[model samples]
Every structure is written in C-alpha cells, then in structure tokens.
Target: MTEDSSQAEHVAGTEHASVADRAAGGKAARAQTPLNSHRGWSPAEDRPDPVALLEEQNLTRVPDLVPVRHGRMMASPFTFYRGGAKIMATDLKDTPRAGLIVQLCGDAHLSNFGVFASPERNLLFDLNDFDETLPGPFEYDVLRMTASFTIAARNNGFSSSDIREVTLEAVRSYREAMIQFSGMRTLDIWYARMSEQELLAAMDMARANQKGKAARKASKALEKNALKNAAKARSRDSMQALAKLAEFVDGHYRIISQPPIVIPVRELAETFGLTAEETEAAVRDQLKAYRQTLQDDRRRLLERFDVVDVAHKVVGVGSVGNRAFIVLLQGRDEQDPLFLQVKEATASVLEDHLPKSIFEQPGERVVQGQRMMQAASDIFLGWTRGMQADRYLYWRQLRDMKGSVVVEAMVPMGMTFYAHACGWTLARAHARSGDPIAIAAYLGGSDKFDRAVTDFAHRYADQNDADYQAFLDAVRTGRLVARGGV
Candidate 1:
C-alpha cells in the first residue's frame, strides 16, 4: 500500500506515462518502482463479490450455457483461476504495477500454454490462447501464470514447500529468459522459439542432478508422457476432428450432435428463436463476408470447399458460455474435410482497464494481437462480423494439433518442467510485444523480483482457494447454479 515516487507520479494523474518516458529510464523506472516493495497481497474490504462479477460477465453470454460455465469453474481452484481472469483484473486494477506495458495473454494460466502446429507443420510450444489479449502491465500475465502454477500444483497434492519451489522456478525462468532476450539482437529475439526437442532437453537438464531412484523414475515417466501428448496433439488435425465429431451418415458427412456440447444448426436455431431457414441463410451470408477477410490464396483455397454442416460447439472453461460454432466444409470429397471454428470474440475483459485496441472490431483485435505476439499463427486465421446476430467472430481451424497440459495428472517433476516451459514461453511472448530491455533492467540479474512474485503467487493462490470454496457454498445454498462437474 506504500507508494514510491514513480507510483505516486502514475497514481496522481489519469493520463498514462508515455512509452518514450520509460524507454529512456529503464534503471530509473526500476529505482522508482521496486518489485520487492509490492510483494504482499490483501484484498480491499470493498472488493466486489466473485459470483457477482461472474454473473455480470454472463450477461453477454449465451443464457442456456452459463450454468455449464459455472459448472466448469466449480470443478477445481485452478479451473476457477482459468475462468476468473475478469475477477482478478478487476482486483488488480487498483494494485501497484511496475508500469512496463506489454501484450498480455490476459488469462495466462498454466493450461493455456501448449503445443500447436506451426505453419510449417512443425510442433511449437507457446502461449496458445488469446481470448483476453490486450496491452497491459507485464505483471498481470506473470501473476496469472504464477498463481495458476501454485493452484495447479496444490491440486495435485503437492506439499506447500514443493508448491513454493514450483512457483519460484516459474518466476525464475521468466526473469532469466527475459534477461537473455534483452542481450540478444532484435531479430534473434523474434526468431527465438521453444521446439519439442528443446522442451525435452530442458526437462532432462532440470532433473539431471536427481540421484534418487524414485526421482529418476518419475522424470522418465514425465518425459514419456510429454512426448506422447505432443504426438497426440500432432494427430488432432482436421481429419482427426472428422473422425471424432463427424460420421458418414447415409453416404454423406454430417456433424454428429451430442447435446449440451454439440448441437446441430437446426437445433441451435431454436435457442436463438429463429427458424431453420432463417438460420441457414444468415450463416451463409456470414461465410461470404468472412472470405473477404482472408488472403487471396487462402480465400481461393476456401472456395474449393462446400459448407455441409454447422453446429454449436461448447469449448473451454472461460469460453463455455460464449457463442462457438464449428463449420464442416467438404473439399474434393468426403475424404477431404476442413473444420473451421467460428468463435464469438467480444470486447476483451482488459479493454476497460488497459489501452484500448486500435482495431474497431473485437474479432480483429484478437486476430491482430495473436499475430503480433505469436511466433507463428494459424494459416486460416481471420475475423468477421456476424450476419444473424450482433457479434464479432474469428475464424480458424478448430483443432490444429492443439494440446494442453492436464495439471491434475502431472507429478512434481512434470509440474516443475511444465512450469519452466510456461515461464519461458510467457517471457518470449512479452519480449516480442514490449521493450525487453526495460523489463530486463527492471528484473535485474538477481532473484529478488522472482522471489517477490513467488510471494505474490502464494498469497493470490490462497485468495483463489478461498474464492473457490465460497463459490461451492454459493452453489450449495442455491445462490448460484452449476450444472455438472468433471
């Protein structure tokens, strides 16, 4: 709660400090805004209710699916963290920040960092979700990740000391990686990426000094699991999607519907209070406008496919209540099918708290931000406005070999390696979008900042756990409704 000169300068006015101001005064900025000073956490007495915040967010989402969203969040504390980005953002709005701006993953939890196919058909490990992407204080993403690791490790029954170590490793990796990036050439920083082999090597090195039989055994199992997951991710392409979600019914490809998760367009129309005829026509028009957003080659390539089916598909925890549709397009024959997800992109949760996006459309904001922060993006990535409803939707392949960590299943050794990977990826992402030099200077060559953030993570994770318990009580008392659990 104590403010330094820089903090006082920032808090005294409504106007934000200029990037130029910080660029010329990295060390001064560090002096003015010491990380060690902002290590503790205490929620304000006026802190808004978490359930109320969630209900406010649910106002813009699909009414029928909001219960499911609550259900997913009720599953675990880490799951709550995934869906509680808006809540945390609101809380952190009044907290002290270092004033170093960057494009935040906004919901930078451990599960959000994953392996996906690069355009060149190679597996790349990076931050994969951008639903809440926006320009904000770099610490927002760091805090989100650190707290996520702490909560996730705690869920797996790790001891408090072990959890602290995991959180420290993550923060340490991020600081060290940012420092490395600061000394690299601009192009080299841009080109720097974590490959599959590099990830395995990192795991190997982290566990190299372990001499215990149980430790070695756990390390080998962890490596094998990671490799297997990566391979599984690589196989989850359009064809795999077709096999899982579609079927050859009466000599034609049709998306199989499993209600509450996948409902065909005809059924989805009723939820919108629209007739089937009106729904199909509206979707057709949306696709036409969507083509214009694509590049010439991609647009031409899309022209070869004929839209056969569209269905409402429920996805991730935070996105459960939002409008998400998957379109099945047949190319050449039934053998060549492309599944494109048309997901609704609303105003980012960070929009009100951070610098507003230059792009007018929310979908465009997401697309542009993803392109800017990601080392490589989806080939078919684009955005379009809705025809039937007032919505902004981004279009991309539903599954481009996307694979994420199941935190509950991870052992201590796997958690450590995964935490480091997440930290390294987040640092690279920040370096790509913001001034790495200023950030690196602020972090310095010591573990002071890392330790400070580790302390913050522990306190925030405690907050998150308390919130999770409150949510369960709310559900039990009929104050809030949750449908099912995992």
Candidate 2:
C-alpha cells in the first residue's frame, strides 16, 4: 500500500471502536502529541516559495483573469491568506498532528462560514464554502479558522488583547461544543443546527449583558445591523440575480455582457472558434448530465425550467480565474427564473500532503465532502465532467439567501460573538463525521488546546504578513502582473 494510504488507514481504524477504546486512544495520543505542542509556527528552511505556489495555481486558471486573482490577493494580508490555502497546506503538513481525522473545510477561514437558506427555506448558519474540502487531521481546520480571526481582527484595527480574546474564544467554543456533542445521541448530533431564531436569541443574550449606556447602544446597533443583513439575504434569490444580470433581447431574456467579468456565451463561442448554436448544444448536454446527479424530485423540478442564457462570470477571491459560469433558466415565464452556477472543481489542496480522495472525479469529491460536512446543503448540488478533457465541474443555485458578515466593520464584541458562533458550528460539522468522544477527551476540560492554537494563529498571521510582502514585491518587479480595483 502507498505510505499516505497506510497512514490514513492507521488513523481511521478506530471508526468502529467502542467509546471507551476511542477515549483511551485519544488520551494515548495526548501523551505522544501534547495539546501544547500546537503552540507555534516556524517555516521550514526548505519551505516552497509562496509566490511560486500561487503562480502554479495560475497555470490551470484562465490566463486573462489570473491577473485579477493576483490583484485580489494583493489587496491585503487577509486577502492573500484567503488565496494562499495551497501555500498553507504545504506548511501545515509539517506541523504536529494528533492523528485524529475528520472531513476538513480545507480552507476554513472566517469568511467561508455564513448564513444560507436550508432545504427547508429557513435561514441557517454553517460552513458555506467547500471548494477545498477533504479528510485530514482536525487541527488543520481549527488552526486555519483561528488564524483567519486573527488576521481579520488585525485588519479591523482591533487591539492585540481583543484579537487574542476573539481567537481564543473561537477554539474554546469548539472544544467545549465537541465535548457536549460527545454525550449526545448520534441522530441528535445529526439534527443539530443553528437557526436564525437561535442566532437572534444569542444576540439578545449578549445585548442583555451589556454594562453601560454606550455599550448597550453599540450592542443594539449591532443587533439591528444583523437583522438588516438577514433581510437583505432573503432578497438575494435567483430573481435578484436575474434582475442584475439579464435583459430583454430579441423577444427573450438573455444575459447582458460585461467584458472580462461577465461575458455572454455568444462572445465566448467566437473566442473558442465555435458557432453560438454549437456552444449552446454542448452546454445543454452538460446540463443533462448534471441533472442526473440530482434526486428524482429535484430533477423533475429542474425539468420545468428551460435555459434562457449563459454567461461566464468571475467569483470569489480565491476562486477567481476558475471556470465559473452562471446559467439563467426561465421556469414558467420571464419572471420565474433560476440561476445555477457551474464552477470548475480542481483537486483539493490537501491532496498533496494527504491520501488522494477516494472519489476519482474531483467534482464528486467536492459534492460528497460538502454533503458530509454541511447540515443542509444546496438542493441543486451536483457534479459533471466538462466537454474539455481534464475538466470537472459542480453545479448549485447561484444565490439562495446567501449572506456573510462584514468582518472588516466588526467591533471587538461583535467579532467575539461571531467567533463563538463559528466555533460551535464547526465542532458540530466535525462531530457529524469524526469521533467526537475521542476528540473531546483529547481536548479534555482545559484550555490548553485553545491557548496553543491562539498563539499559533498570531504567529501564522506574522508569517502571512511576510508572505504578503513577497507577493507585493513580485507584482512590483513585474514578476507577476496584477489589475487592482476590480
């Protein structure tokens, strides 16, 4: 057997072990890799060049849009970190591990967690992005999450003490929540989710604890802002997307052209030396294949719609340059619209240092990993191979009441509250796929893991700053090209 596979098998062997045995194994792991061992970061002398790693990713992405990705990453250290998952994955491979494995949100930074519509149409908060999801050591997600909080807080001009407190609270919440999940029934853990009502209640409790007039006023403002954001999210469905992207053309709705960022399929057909009809036929065939991946009811529902227009669109800081297309479909009439986004799925960044995914198709790996980790995933989530060789893609609703917190505008209290929420949510996700009993036992009732990870987060943020400077230097010297303010 391959060494990577063997290591994975060794770590995963306790899956069916008794509770007592699992807990014992966790304690044994503590002896071998102490909780405090996760306390620091020092890049190895032979660490790969961060800029080089990014450029390597650019090799697979659209050439013209690659500069946009570079520009996004050049905005700040936090943006760079968001786009530097591959670089971090390389560095994390050499870090201490307890051998406890779980389905990782390989890029589990703060912005990746958000509120979205559940299949039930209720608003729920959970991990929203799974582009880099994979199975690996649980600490990988935890450390990446904590470091994101640190970097975001620094960007917001938070005090060092406040930043540390926010980061520490996030890990503490995860550790404590995992311990709680350890005692719950398997089905109960599966059913657990953070609904909008629960979130509002938590906010109310925080507001009640405020001391003085100014603090109370600020807390109330934060609560008000959250409600406004939720209301905005509710308005961000396919209709909203249609209004923004489609226009009446030749007696039918068609996607409007916005050069570079959003170009209609006709424009792309010419660029690729194909007739417009041929391009549409190929897209329709691909959509048919993607439809087969959906459930019977969803597939029937999709059958009610007809493709109106398709456009290539740029999306996300890290996902820019990747092939992402938005398809506008009309249900009964022009007003009834559904927007589906087809995004290219490359191999997980974690694959280099961990065992390759069991699923052969990269798109299926993302779809399956997302289904395993999320309490409620997008109903339209599915995968298909693109017409081009070596291309795999996944499809989902372009927008379904999706919203994220403005980390840049957050105050200390708001950020700490967010940290706690993300921590608990992440633990619940991990518990669904990992042995919570063993992980909780390893963490114990102490804050050792929390403190150690928080320390590591600060150090990692420093490393990120150094890497950001290197990237900026590369751009300035024309080693890399960047188009900012996109």
The top-ranked prediction according to lDDT is: 2
| Per-model TM-score versus the true fold | 0.93, 0.97
State the lDDT of candidate 2 residue by residue for 109-215, as single tens digits.
Answer: 99999999999999999998899998888999999999999999998899999999999989999999999999998899899999989999999999899999998
Off by over 4 Å in 1: 1-24
Clashing pairs in 2: none
* Candidate 1, 1-486: lDDT as tens digits: 122223222222223445555344566667777879658878888999998888889999888898899899988898888899888988777666777777778888898889899988888999888988877788888988998899999898999889988999899999999988877877898888898889888778756877898898888888888889999999999999999999798999899989889999977788777798988888888888888888899899988998888999999999998889999999999999999999999888887676666678989888877887788889889999976467899999999999988888887778888888888899999898777777888888889988998888888888998889888898999988889852
lDDT of 1 at 48: 90
lDDT of model 2 at residue 354?
87
What's the true lDDT of residue 201 in model 1?
86
